[model samples]
Target: MTKKSRRTHSPAFKAKVALAAVKGDKTLAELAQLFDVHPNQITLWKNQLLEGAAGVFG
Candidate 1:
């Protein structure tokens, strides 16, 4: 059996996923499956995106 390797996601990819999460177009589980990442990771990125969005205006 082969071991699963750790994957490193780029900022753009994370942003895309986070944006999708923000859009509410798909459920967290769906996003996780689509992005090949954990639901929690997507949520974290989504929250980070939201938290930092204010910086753009500030």
Candidate 2:
């Protein structure tokens, strides 16, 4: 059996998905399916966005 190819997503895409997660309009599972990524990844990006949001104020 062949291994599935790994995919790389752009920062803009990650930010968009993470922003959607922050919006609270969809569940992690839903976002995962919609973005074709793992739920944990979505959570990670969301946390990153939150952690870095303070930079915008500086």
**Which ranges of candidate 2 are over 4 A from the true structure?**
none
Cα lDDT of model 2 by residue, 1-58, tens digit? 9999989999999999999999999999999999899999999999999999999999
Misplaced by over 4 Å in model 1 are: 1-4
For each candidate, the alpha-carbon lDDT, in order, equals 0.96, 0.97
The Cα error of candidate 1 at residue 31, in Å, is: 0.7
Q: Which window of 10 residues has the lowest lDDT sum in candidate 1?
A: 28-37
TM-score of each: 0.89, 0.91
Residue-by-residue lDDT tens digits, candidate 1, 1-58 = 9999999999999999999999998999999999898999999999999999999999
Which pairs of residues have clashing backbones in candidate 2? none
Steric overlap count per candidate:
0, 0
Best by lDDT: 2
